[model samples]
Target: MSDNLLSRFLRYVRIDTQSDETSKTFPSTPGQLVLLEMLKQELTELGAADVQMTRPGYVMASISANTRKARVPTVAFLAHVDTAPDCSGKNVKPIVHRKYDGRVVKFPDKPGLTLDPATSPELRTAIGKDIVTASGTTLLGSDDKSGVAVIMTLVERLLRETKRKHGLIRVCFTPDEEIGRGVDKLDLRMLGADVAYTLDGGPPGEICWETFSGDAAEVIVDGITTHTMEAKAKGMVNAAYLAGKLLAALPRERCAPETTDGRDGFIHPIHVEGRTERSVVKFLLRDFELNGLADKGKILRGLCRGLQASEPRARVRCKLRKQYRNMAYWLRKDMRPVELAREAFVAAGLKPYDHVIRGGTDGSRLTELGLPTPNLFCGEHNAHGPLEWVAVQDMESAVSACAQLAELWERKS
Candidate 1:
C-alpha cells in the first residue's frame, strides 16, 4: 500500500495541473482535464461503480454497500485535482528520502535551497519516516495530490476487502480548488451522499471543522489620462498612483497574512494590474467569523471611498465577491461527522485532534451547502510553495483512517 501510494503521488505531481484564475473556462486549465480523465479510468479499473467524468470535469464513482444492516448513510470522499498557481508545478522532480535521519535535506536543482529541521519544525517530526519533496525549482503539489492518492488508495483497498462491512462510498475528484471554484458547478443531488470529507488538510490525525470565512474584493480605479505636456495637477488623475495609495493605506500591521496567525484574520492583496487610465487591485478578505469578515470588507471599502473622495473625477469601485464561509458555523450545529472521524483515527492507531484551517477547502463550501463536510489530513506541509512535502507513512495512515471511518459509520447507523 505504501509503495502504491508513493508511486501514485509521484506520478500525479509530475503532471502540471496548475489552475489559471484568469481563465474563463470552468476548470481554468487544460491539464486538469487530463488528470480528471486519468482518474476516471483508474476508478473504473479499480472496480468502482458508475464511474464517469461529470460536468465541469469532476470524476465521480461509487462502491456498493457490503453491510447487511439496512439504512446506512452514503459517505463521500473527495480531493481536488488542481494545484495552486502560486509557484511552478511543471516538470516536478519528486525526491523520496527513505528513513530520514534528522539531517538537513538539500535540493539538487537549487544549490542554495535546503530543508532543515531548524527552520522547518515539521521536518523534525518526520525524521524517521519517508519524506517526499520536489526539486527546488517547483512546488511539490502535495496540497491536494496527497489527498487524491489517499482516496484512490482507499477505493482500491475497500473494493478488495469484499468481506469488510461498510456503507456505500462515493469518490469524487474535483478541479480548480486552488482558485476557489472547486464545487461551484457541482450538483449536490447528483453526488448522492448524505455527508462528505475532503482529504485536503495538513499533517496527520488532523480533523479540521473550522475554516476562515472567505471573500474577495476587486478595487478598480479609473482615472483620466493626459499627455505629459498637457498634464496638470487638476487635469491629470493617475489611476496607478491612486492604486498604490490604496495599497499603502491598507492596515500594515494588524490585518496582513504575514503578520497574523492563529485565529487572527487577514486582508490579503493578491493581484494588482492595469496602468494610468485604469488600474485594478484584488484583495482576499478572510476571518473565522462572519462579522470579522464583514469588518475586513468595510475596511477595504472605506479605503476606496477615501480614494474616491481625494479625486472626485476618478471612479473608484470596490466589488466584493463572497467565497466559502467558515465551515465551523455549520459543523458546530451537528458534530457527528467530526466525532466519527475522531473515532476512526483512533481505530487507525492515530491520536486524533481537532484543527482549524487558516485557509478554506472544498469542505468549507460543502458544509455551507448543508452537507456537513469536514477536512482530514493527508500529510501535506508547506503547501503552495517550493518547500512543500508529504510523508508517505502519513498518507498511508490517512487511507487507514478513511477506511475505519466508513466502518464506524456503518456500525453507528
Candidate 2:
C-alpha cells in the first residue's frame, strides 16, 4: 500500500482528543486513550514488537535491529497524542489545498480568517506543493498529529521493507503534552533508549534542542461580597477588581507574548476565572535564560504583593510552580545525537538547521528524565490555531529523514 500521510493525519485529528488542564487523572482525558489504543493496535498489525498501551494511555513499540552491527545505539522517536485545548478540537473540518499557488487562501467557514503569505512566510515554501489545513473554525492539529503520522508511516515501511538496514528503533506516543504534564507519569526506565528524537517541530529542516525555561503561577483573590446596590465601601472587596488590578500592574510592552519575539521571553496570562466573591488568574512564564524566568516570577510576586497591600480587605496569594527547562543543557554534553540527525538530513538530500522551540515539548520533559531527546521537524506550521497548515511534501521529507536516521546510527556503530 502506498503511504497516505495526509490521510493518516486527517484521520487522527478527527477524533477530538483535546486534553483537559483541570483534570486530576493521569492522561487528563479519556478521548486520548482511544487514539492511543488505535495506535497500539495498528502497531501490532504492522508486526512491531513489544507493542503495548500502558495504564497512563501511552503506546510504546519497538522494531528489532535488522542491521549486522553489534553496537548500534537504540534510538527512539516520540509524539504526543493529545491536541492543545486553546482551540476547539471537536468536529474539526480539515481543508486540503492542492498545488498551492503562493497566494492567500480564504476559508468558507470563517469569513475573515485567511492563510496569509505575509504573516507566515513558510507558506511560500509550499508553493507548487500540496498543503493540509483546517477550515478556520478549528485548529488543524498538525502540531503533533503530523508527527504521529510520519513516525507511524515510517515504522510500517521499516517493518515491511526487508532490505532496509537499521538499528533497534523504538517509538512512543505520549498524552497531555499541551498541558505540561506529558512526561509526568512516563516510565522512562521502560522506554530504554540511549537517545531519542521527538518528531514535533515546524518546517522541514528545523532540528530543535533549545527550548524556553518554563514556569507557571496562579493568583487567587478572595473578596467579602455583599449586594452591590446596598453596599458602598462597607466591607465589600470585589475580587474582580483586584484581579484586574493585578493584571494591569504587569508591563505588557516589555514582556508580553504579543510584544516579544525570538530570544526575548514573555509572561502571558493563559486563563482567568472571575466572580464577585473569588477570582483566579493563571500565567505562564518563559525565557531562554534561567535568570530571566526567575525574574519574571519575581516581578509577578511583587505585583501580587502590591495588589494585596492596596486591597487590604481582600485576601490575595500567588503560588508558583516549575515546569520544564532548556534541553540544550543536556544535549550539548555529547552532541553526537544532534550530529547523527544532521547526517540523516544530508543523507536524505536535505539541509539540516538548528531551531529553538519557544514552547516546551514531550522532549523537554523526556530529556529532563535522563534521556537525551531533541526535536525533529515534521511540517507543522501556524500551530494551535485556525490558520494551521502542513505541506504534504514536508511530511514525505520527514519520513525519509526518519528512515535514513536509523540507518545512519547503524553505520556509525
Candidate 3:
C-alpha cells in the first residue's frame, strides 16, 4: 500500500495542476483538466462503475457495494486535484527519504533552505518512517495530491478485496480548491451521496468539521490622471495613493492574518493592482462565526466609505461577496458524519482528534449545500509552499481509516 501510494502521489505531483485565480475558465487552468482526465481514466481502469469526468473538470466515480446490508448509506470521498497558485508546482520532483532519520534536512536546489526536525515537531514523529518532499525550487503539491492518492488507493484496495463487506462508495476529484472555487460547478445531483468527506486536511488522525466562514471583497478606486508637468494636488487625485492610504488604514496590528490565530478572525488584503488613474484591491474576510465575518465586512465597508468621503473627487466602491461558510454551523446539528470518522480512525489504530481550520475547504461549501461533509487528514503539512511534505506511512493510515469508515457506515445501517 505504501509503494502504491507513493507512486501515485509522485505521478500526480509531477503534473502541474496549479489553479489560476485570474483566469475566467471553469477549472481555471488547462493543466487541471489534464489531471482530471487522467483520474477519470484511472478510475475506469480500476473497475469503478459510473466513472465520468464532468465538463467542469470534476472526476466522479463509484465502487459498487459488496455487502449484504440492505440499508447502507452511499458514502462519498472527495479530494481536490489542483494545487495552490501561491507556489510553483511546475516540474515538481518529489524526493522520497526511504528511512527518515531525525536530522536537519536540506534541499538540493536551494542551498540556503533547510528543514530542521527540531523546529517542525510534526516531522519528528516520522523519525523511522518514509518522508516525501520537493526540491527547494518548487512546492511538493502535497496539499491535496496526497488526498487524491489515498482515495485512489482505497478504491484499489476495496476492488481487490471482494470479501471486505462495504456499501457503495463515491469518489470525486475536484479542481480549483486553492482559489476557493472548487465546487462552483459541481453536479451534486449527479454525485448522489447521503454523506461525504474531503481528504484535504493536515497531520494524521485529524478530523476537521469547523472552518472559517469566508467572504471576498474588492475595492475599486477610480481617480483622475494627469501629466506630471501639469500635476497638482487639487487638479489630480492619484488612485494608487488613495489605495495605499486605505491599506495603511486597515487594522494590520490586530485584525490581520499575520497577527490572528485560533478562533480569531482576520481581514486579509491579498492582491493590489492598477495605476494612478484606477486601482483595485482584493481582500479576503474570514471568521469562524457568521457575525464575526459580517463584522469584518462592515469594517471594510466603513473604511471604503471613509476613503470616499476623504477623497470626494475619486470614486471608491467596494464589492463584498460570499465564498464559503463554516461547516460546523450545519455539522453540529447532526454529527453522525464526524462520529463515523472518529470511530473509523480508532478502528484503524489511530487516536482521532478534533481540529478547526483557520481557512475553508470544499467540504465547507458541501456541508452548506446539505451534504454534511467533514474533512479527513492525508498527512499534508506546510501546504501551498516549497517546504510542503507528507509521510508515506501516514497516507497509508488514512487509507485504512477510509476503508474502516466505509465498513462502519455499512454496519450502522
Candidate 4:
C-alpha cells in the first residue's frame, strides 16, 4: 500500500498540470486534461463504474458495494489535479529520502538549498520518517497529488480486499483549483453524492471547517499626462505617484501577510502597474466574519474616496467583487459530514485537529452548492514551493482514513 502511494504520487506529479490563472478556458490549461484522462483510465482499470472525464477536466467515478445494503448514503472523495500557478510544476523530480536523519537535507541540483530544521519547525515532528521532496529547482506539486494518491490507493485496496463492507463511493478529480476557478464549471448533479470531503488540506490529522470570505479590489487611477519638457506643474498629474499615495494611506500593520494569522483579516496588494496616463492596483481582501469583512470593505472604499479628494485632477475608481464566502456559516446545522469525518479519524487511530484554512478550497464553494463538504489532510507541507514535501506514512494513514469514512457512511445508513 505504501509503495502504491509513493509510486502514484510520483506519477501524478510528473505530469506538469499547472493551472493558468490568465487563461479564459474552463480547465485553464490543456495539461490538466491530460492527467484527467489518465485518471479516468486508471479508475476504469480499478473496476470503478461510470468513469467519465467532462469537457472542463472534471473526472468522476463511482465504486458500487457488493453488499445488499438498503439506502446507504453515497459519500464522495474529491481532490484537485492542477498544481498552483505560484511555482513551476514542470519536469518534477521526486527525491525520496528513506529514514530521515533529522538533519538539514540538501538537494542535489541546488547545493545552496537545504531543508533546514531550524526554520521549518514542523520537521521536528517528522523525524525518522520516509519523506518525498523536490530537487529544489521546482515545486514538488504534492499539494493535491498527495490527496489524489490517497483516494486512488484506498479505492484499489477496497476493490482487492473482499472483507471490507462499504457503500457506494464517488471520486472526483477537479482542475484549476489553485486559481480560485475550480468549482466554476463543476457539475454537482452528475457527482450525485449526499456529502463529500476534499482530501486536499496540508499535513496529517488536520481538518478545516472554516475558510475566509474573500473579494478582489481593483483600483484604477486616471491622471493627465504632460510631456517632461512641459512647464512645471501646469498640466502634469503623475498617476504613478497617485498609486503610491493610495497604497501608502492604507494601514501599514494590516497589509502584510507575515503579520497576520488565525482569523485576522488583511488587504494584500497583489499587482501594481502604472504609467503617466493611468495606473491599476489589484488587492485581495479576506476576512473570516461577514460583518468584519463589510467593515474592511468600507475602510478600503473610504481610503479611495480620500485619494479622490486629494487629487482633484486625477480620477480614482475602485471596484470590489466578492469571490467566496466563509464556510463556517453553513457548518452549524449542515455539518453532519464533518462530525462523521471526526469519528472516522478517531476510528483510524488518529486525533483530528480542526483549523480555519487561511485560504479558500473547492470544498468551500461545494458547501454552498448543497454538498456540505469539508477539507481533510493528505500530509503535504509547504505547498507551491520548491521545498514542498509529503510523508509516505502520513499518506498511508490518509488512505486508511478515507476507507474508514466510507465504512462509517455505510453504517450510518
Measured against the true structure, the TM-scores of the candidates, in listed sequence, are 0.99, 0.97, 0.99, 0.95
Worst 10-residue lDDT window for candidate 1 reads: 225-234
- Tell me the tens digit of each residue's lDDT in model 3 across 325-354: 999999999999999999999999999999
Please list the residue runs of candidate 4 whose C-alpha ends up more than 4 Å from where it truly belongs after superposition. 231-234
**Residue pairs in candidate 3 whose N, alpha carbon or C atoms collide under 3 angstroms:** none
Q: For model 2, what is the alpha-carbon lDDT of residue 218?
A: 97
Model 3 ranges off by over 4 Å: none
What value of lDDT does candidate 4 attain over all alpha carbons? 0.87
Between prediction 1 and prediction 2, which has the larger TM-score? Answer: 1
Give all candidates' CA lDDT scores.
0.94, 0.90, 0.94, 0.87
Stretches of candidate 1 exceeding 4 Å from the true structure: none
Clashing pairs in 4: none
**CA lDDT, candidate 2, residue 57:** 76
Backbone clashes counted, model 3: 0
Residue 385 of candidate 1: its Cα lDDT?
A: 90
RMSD in angstroms, all models? 1.0, 1.3, 0.9, 1.7
| Superposition error at 95 for model 4 (Å) | 1.0
- Please provide, for model 1 over 1-413, each residue's C-alpha lDDT reduced to its tens digit, 9 standing for 90 to 100: 99889999998999999999999998999999999998999888989999989877899999999989899999999999999999998899999999999899899999999888888998988988999999999999998999999999999999998777899999999999999999999988999999999999888899999999999999999999988788895498899999999999999799999999999999999999979899999999999989999999999999999999999999999999999999998888899999999999999999998998999999999998989899999999999998998999999999999999999999999
